[model samples]
Target: MTFSKPYATREALEQTIAHHAWLNEHAGSLRLPAIRTVRADGIDFASIEGRHARFTDAPAVATVLGRAHAAAWKGDLHRALLTTAHPLAHGHELPDFVSPRIAALRRHRAAGLVNAHQMTAAQSLLAASPATPVAFYKDTNLRNVLITADGPVMVDLGDLTLAPFGYDLAKLLVTLAMTYGPLPPATFTTSLACYNQPLLGAGLPPVTIGRFLGHAELHHLLTLPYLGKSGYRHPWPTVRPRPEDLT
Candidate 1:
């Protein structure tokens, strides 16, 4: 593969290359398409052999999400969360959110997409909380998950890492919430219930589900600009949610 244009910096380029290598080496085990080549601008994905399929041509607002929920209607989402044990179980510490991310939250507040009440409460809670690592899908969302008859396969390999369990849950749920706006509290119960307590197992503590949901809410605002088409239309904070309101 060849990049039509280079990545923003050397570090970005190197990271992309590394992720590509990881994905290439592990795609079959990951149940994903092998990459014969990848560059900053293009990729050559090995075709699926049999009756492969996509989620839908015109996924309704919740189609990808609903499908994810239905697919995981069984147990063990952590299995779904990672491609394999290949990455050496990354991100043991909760890395600090960078400055640009903070700025995006500020922008959300400024644009009335997030209010001070939610912001303050979430920030305070996050600041006080210690890091707890679990499976993390950094870009966990409808867009990143692929459906095959074989089962669910995580497509975007780069974002897979070990992070707070709440974080992985938050990103997928919040990623949906961001696109469709605030779903009723019952939405999580019905659609996201597969990842609930029984599945998390007793070895881990109760995840700060709301706190991490808030983090996911804040985390993706900065990411919108980079996501073409994906960034369109989801006017956030129009109703001014409390931090715990993300159900």
Candidate 2:
């Protein structure tokens, strides 16, 4: 099968295997399925056996996102709170190919088609947030999540980072919004309520709830190029002049 961009590297595959094993050992409470590491050319490949859910409808996507948000909130408040704090290091920045794309965004911003302030705000939140939960999965897009007879199983670990609790939620929400337009306010509100209730039940502070919403919005804006016509259908042209070249 043809895989998406940012295909798993040997080192990344090893790290994922190690992480899965560590989680199994330390957090036996999580009922995750077994995963084996495949080494080829001294590189590791991910191997998991499970079905994946196809998110064709908004409600279905919302359900998965909501459940993930709630679970993240319940499982780790500190990390959730920090979702607005810690930013990934430059070397670990998203999509593993962001320099050029960010440059494109800069040009778009200069044209007043995109908002610079909003993008900056999102970056600031990510930088300020505390390190994410150890078990936090960053990329929660449809391509990464798989549905099995039992439940959803995430496979891609490329975007996994130690930055914030709801980083994954924000990522998923942003993708959903770009693909389907704005989410229903009521649905988001309900999801937030459900997310906060468990934390309240556990006597944790619910401060990050607002930050999560803000980040979700910002993520949508920053990732706009990857969705809609700019994405899969119309890729950025190769050999395009630099932003300075246009001047």
Candidate 3:
């Protein structure tokens, strides 16, 4: 996937190019496609070939996530990933994207699209998870991950950032809920149990895991409006949670 650097100066684009390169710099289960080139003369380009992700598919994404999380903890790649990702233009920001979900919520709130309770719920979520950074692909929905023959690879690391582990997990869960339906109770529970295995093994407090999941769920709600602003394209819809839904 290719994107034009929103900024005119080379400063932002230069940093983003580094983020692209860092994905390939690592040697591990979570490695992504090598960036062929990033053209900054006019429009930016970070291209790669042989994506061929059909083989890895959905389950492969989970395998990569489980492994990445575990490997991040075990080999201490977590710090390495964070160190490499920190120089990125957008790495340090909260919500991880240029258009952050919380900022989106504030806009909707001003327009009276959503009530304060939703904001309160979202705030509570943010308070729960630690603000620690990690090597995370901010966009992990099914479409972004490519199931390649070499291994399950993640594409579109453009949004890679140093953010809460739960944020990445929550974004994936939110995408699944939007694409499928309400979070599958049994499946969601099981998946978190699995995702948190590494975090727990790494010595994080047990309650922190629940906080990350809750924080991420609220992040989904916050992102809905921004998704709508983008024309509610496929996998995006112009909607927000009802009051009862928040409770």
What tens digits encode model 1's per-residue C-alpha lDDT throughout 83-145? 223232232221233333455667777877666776675455334223333333345566655
Instruction: Give the alpha-carbon lDDT of every model.
Output: 0.44, 0.45, 0.51
Per-residue lDDT tens digits of candidate 2, residues 55-118?
Answer: 2332344345444434544444333333232223233321212233355557668866578686
Model 3 lDDT tens row, 92-185: 3212422355577788789876678877877655442223535355477645655545655666544555545655655665565555445434
TM-score of 2: 0.56
Ranking by TM-score: 3, 2, 1
Candidate 3 lDDT (Cα, 0 to 1)? 0.51
lDDT of 2: 0.45
Ranking by lDDT: 3, 2, 1
Global CA lDDT of candidate 1, please? 0.44
**Clashing residue pairs, candidate 1?**
none
Candidate 2: stretches off by over 4 Å:
1-8, 23-33, 41-116, 127-135, 207-209, 229-247
